[model samples]
Target: MNMVNTQVRLAARPVGLPGDGDWTVTEERLPALETGQVLVRTLYVSIDPAMRGWMRGTPSYLPPLGLGDVMRAWTIGMVEDSRNTLFAEGEIVTGMLGVQRYAVTDGRGVTKIDPAEGPVSAHLGVLGVPGLSAYIGMLDIGRPREGETVVVSAAAGAVGNVAGQLARIHGCRVIGVVGGQEKCRHVVEDLGFDAAVDRRTEDVAEALRRHAPQGVDVYFDNVGGEVLDAAVRSLARGGRVVLCGAVSQYNSENGVGGLPGYISLLINRARMEGFLVFDHADRYPEARARLREWVKEGSLKVVEDVVPGRVVDFPRLLLRQFDGGNTGKLLLRVED
Candidate 1:
């Protein structure tokens, strides 16, 4: 099989928001598939706030993307050819396929996706990494008890939207903190959260007081920084604060900002825990099965913001996640 490979490569390390010159576009020919390998035609590429960290040459949980390498991304595509017995040709799959028109992998991380069960884009959102993050962050770390209050920042994002809704499912009163009023409305009406605070226009602490009233039991934080500070001030006794992602600090040109004092945690008798979704790999199937069941029963809502263009638009779409331009799981459409 022959196909053109238009790939997005890292040109320079971005200091803050990535510019046009930060990436270089290149083209290559598709390579042949080997035993246990499958050739995939790129369909959609996910844009996550984590990508900003990946571009920097720093020590993180994972190695940073080296200069001139194909920018890493989560992609959903169709198998054009397969030498792997586990996946047949023409099957839809999703994984870290990078930014290119085509990908060839040994099927190590790539998994099959079925649109019949739900929209294919959902495998990248509600049923994918973001969804898993929400499930584990809320239940495993936040541990919202019944009649408790669960507050989430980036409340309309891929992870936060699901996290807030899942908290409600477990009988916790859910309060969402979003960047704008429109997003606040969407979180309350569309996602069915108990209350939605517009962090951009309203004072978060005041809003939290009006919404939660009794103080927050679990803070499922996505956009950290000041939101963390507000949650701390309003946390109830034995409250749990889940540190998921901090879009606010992701692009801080100097460094990650400092949070409020640890003494606050002691005074409140509250605990704050950091979580990476991959840490729950062993339990992904368990989480996915339950989330899938919810989707089938119309209990869970899946939202996706798709930007259409070629592979070159990957960098632009990646920046949107940090800019609050996306409402749900953000993806770049690589093919028509």
Candidate 2:
């Protein structure tokens, strides 16, 4: 097939938040699929805080995006053409398809999506990496027990919201730490969180104390830095801290901020562990089944912030995640 694919490529490594100069948008005709490869027309590209980390040249869990490489991203799209036996034309799939209007893959990490489970965009949010991260971080790592106090930083976000709600489902008191009043209200009233701390207006440590007077038994942290320190200071005896992500420090020109409250972990006999969602890929089927069930029964709500734009809009759209401009999962809908 003959087609021109629009793509966003890394033009330069960014100092802080990436700007237009850091990227170059171009269009190129796609080549014919090789044997064992599939052609995907990008539908929704996931915008995540980790994308910022991936932009740096520093060593990380994954390799940094090479200069001039297609901006790495997880995307959900339909298989428009396929030479791979594992994938079929018309099948919806999700994988690291990058920031392009079309992706050609060998089906290595791609997975088929069952639309009957929920809206396809949901696969990028509630049932995708965000949901899996929350599930493993909360259930497998934090291990919240009934009536325990669970606090989630960035609670209005994709992973944080689901983490807080999962704790609530397990009979824990869920307190969300979010940015603004509207987000605070959204978590508490709309997402069934027991309480919310407006990190912008309220003192986080003081708020956590007020909400979790018994102490935070489990703290699922998304935004590290001051918020992480506050959570550490408020940890209950034998508390568990799940270090999911550090959105707060992702854009820092200096290195990641100091954690002053880390000493409290030793004092409280608590443990803090960092996790990558890809590490738990073996259990995705199990996680997806449970998430799908909860979403179906209205026990877990799915929230997505999707901006429809072409591939060229990716750079600007991704900035939304860093500035707290979006609630829930942030996705760039690749316009056909």
Best-performing candidate as measured by TM-score: 2
In model 1, how large is the Cα lDDT of residue 58? 87
Q: Candidate 2's residue-wise lDDT over 1-336, tens digit each?
A: 789999899999998899989999889999988999999999999999989989998779888789999999999999999999999999999999999999999999899988876689998898888999999999999999999999999999999999999999999999999999999999999999999999999999999889988899999999999999999999999999999999999999988999988998899999999989888888888998999899889989888898998888888888889899899999989887
Clashes of each: 0, 0
Off by over 4 Å in 1: none
lDDT of 1 by residue, 1-336 (tens): 567788899999987888898999998887777899898889899888888888999868789899999998999999988999998888999999998888889999888898777789888888889999999999899888889999999999999999998998889889999988889889999989989888888898888888877788999988878888888788887888999988899888877767764566898899999989888899799999999998888888888888889888887778788888789888887755
lDDT of 1 at 99: 89
Candidate topping lDDT: 2
Q: If scored against the real structure, what TM-score would every candidate get? A: 0.96, 0.98
| lDDT, residue 77, candidate 1 | 95
